[model samples]
Target: MTPVLDPDTSLWHVIALEVQRQRIAHDLSVTQLATRLRVDRSTVSRIEHGWRKLSPEQADGLDAMWDLQHLFRRLVRFAAATDDGNWFTGLMDFEKEASLHRMWEALLVPGLLQTPDYARAMISTKSADVEAGLETRLARQASVFDGERAPRVSVILNWAAIEQCVGGRDVMRGQLAHLLEMGERPNVNIRVMERDAGAHVGLDGSFRLLTISDREIAYSASPERGRLVLEASDVHDYAVRYDLISNLASPVGASRRLIEQALEA
Candidate 1:
């Protein structure tokens, strides 16, 4: 079954209304629609009321039988993209809408840059459904970061994060190589901050700053919690800190050189 959509988003209302409109237009009662779709009447009722989820197969059946022009199929994707968590939804939405994105990492490779093996090793250890979380993250890279029109991106990695050996040797090497490959893209700038730089403003934490529409927002996540920075002052502070840390990190060319060196090791 597809996941429930966040009612906070207008898309949720649109989908519910669409389903109801289709049923009424066809002069079909909830029971008739449910029977036609081979689902329980309660399922059809829940879909119209936005209380339960409609499975993708069932949605496609609705679309095919009702001649929805693939509308339900598309709406199913929107519902699948959302879940019941505030932690990932906000930043993900910002990423979709943002034109520019910058991030710094002190402990582990940033999610956007991780290889599947590395990401699987990390996320599976934390979440109940490791495969689901891992695939979701990988899917985000394709949908949000891989295109030419994707957000102009920059990332600074602490030397320790690169050297810590999170997923063992082979996975780490693949990840490093992937970094160099992604860095070659015009829109992606990946850098490494040598521990030698020692004691910079970013010592406080890792944060991500994004340019959304005309405004800037920042986010910080820790093992304990995550924070969304909305105040202009706070967002500016992170941007300033990012600039300082980027200065400390090796420049793109030298950064790729560092990654190459690590790949050799």
Candidate 2:
């Protein structure tokens, strides 16, 4: 049986449900719908499950097929107009529930591994209440790192992020020391990607893949905002990217030595 999407989740969810409903009403199988859209079968599945956004072109194709007078295209525009500024908020909730986390950061320490001072230094530029945001970040770290039920975490961080001072020398030293300490935990693994490795796949950006309950979620962020990805195929791509990054990273022991070297330098 095909699962139904809860229409109230988001406008995209409503669009997905409508697409699925129209396809079924016209006696079309998923494969048939995919053929009509000139997209892969998996694309149709992702759309129906609200895991992927319906693209403008795909919406036009569907509207033409069903003679819906561009209804899907109009819905897509409306969904695009609404700013999902709460994506990071959603990420916080997912992080608390995730059982396994694989993260890759090219420029800075991952937030879960940041010292309060380091976190504050970055948060202060964007937030009106630095202390409040700092408190929330500390709480998030405690939830993921201090508890017995803490998730298994693997991090691949660029060496430059360790070498470059954040929050001045004292705070940078504390952050490095904190990373070394966190790396000692049995459930946490940290590896460093050397700057000398030339260019690599991770140079594009930072991303994290999390396993929550039994489902996988991926997140990629820019300075403006972050996006939460739920499509299985897209999440798998992130997993593969993580593996590629791990290949270029130093082993945990070597990474520890690198951190120790930076602390001394």
Candidate 3:
């Protein structure tokens, strides 16, 4: 038997294809599988296409249905861990299949739209073992626009991010300009939360919520805590926090003016 590919290394598209193949071999139509899984046919299709992630319970069901108990266990473990390498690999899987990405940045601009100069400055300040962080950052951004499945992203940045001037005047200016350009895209949305905004949960740090179909996963950074991956209940909490932050954030039109003002200043 050929060795089974590690789901972490395989693209999400490939994973979905394998799932579809197994379902077919078992003589299961989408509706039939959905009935067994207690979900809608479209939900089954989304899972098979990697447009939705399997929760732990769903993974267990899949394992029994496909005789993949071991593989499913490994996938659940991978999802629960904080390994940056593994986390990034999983992110690549989602990036390949996700239809939308919703993110909140309290510290700096999110990685996907960072300019090279801005990226270098941010990476230079980090103590991470990873060298060429800037290069990797750029590559991730390129991936977003590279293919047909390019994610529709909505990013909310804190007003303080613009005021902090991570890379000084020239670089900050360029970054703001880049944000302006990226915001013009049909699939991208940019907003800013003002300092005066009262009581928002995301004031602590940056977090991202990636959506595939209707399933969402949350990720956050920590020093002692490391990378935190939240699903199910935790995912819902973070989503609520995101909504609160967005409510207090500047509107899109106002956010544009604020960026313009920062550029002028």
C-alpha TM-scores of all predictions: 0.67, 0.71, 0.68
Q: Give stretches of model 3 more than 4 Å off.
A: 1-86, 127-131, 223-230
lDDT of 2 at 73: 77
How do the residues 1-265 of candidate 1 rate in per-residue lDDT, one tens digit apiece? 5455454664556677788888999999999998999989998888877776667798799889978776687566555654444445667656776788899988888888889999998987778898899888887787667656778988899887778787889999998888888898888888899879978888788889989767898998787567677669998988889989887888888888888988999
**Each model's lDDT:** 0.81, 0.88, 0.75
Report clash pairs, candidate 2. Answer: none
Q: Regarding TM-score, does 2 or 3 come out ahead?
A: 2
Q: What does candidate 2's lDDT look like per residue over 149-243, in tens digits?
A: 87999999998889888889999999999999999989999999998988888999999999977678899978888788766999999889999
List runs of model 1 lying over 4 Å from the truth: 1-85
TM-score of model 2 vs. true structure: 0.71
Candidate scoring better on TM-score of 1 and 3: 3
Residue pairs clashing in model 1 are none
Candidate 1, 120: how far from true, in Å? 0.3
Error of 3 at 161 (Å): 0.9
Cα error, residue 14 of model 2, in Å, equals 3.1
Give the higher-lDDT candidate: 1 or 2: 2
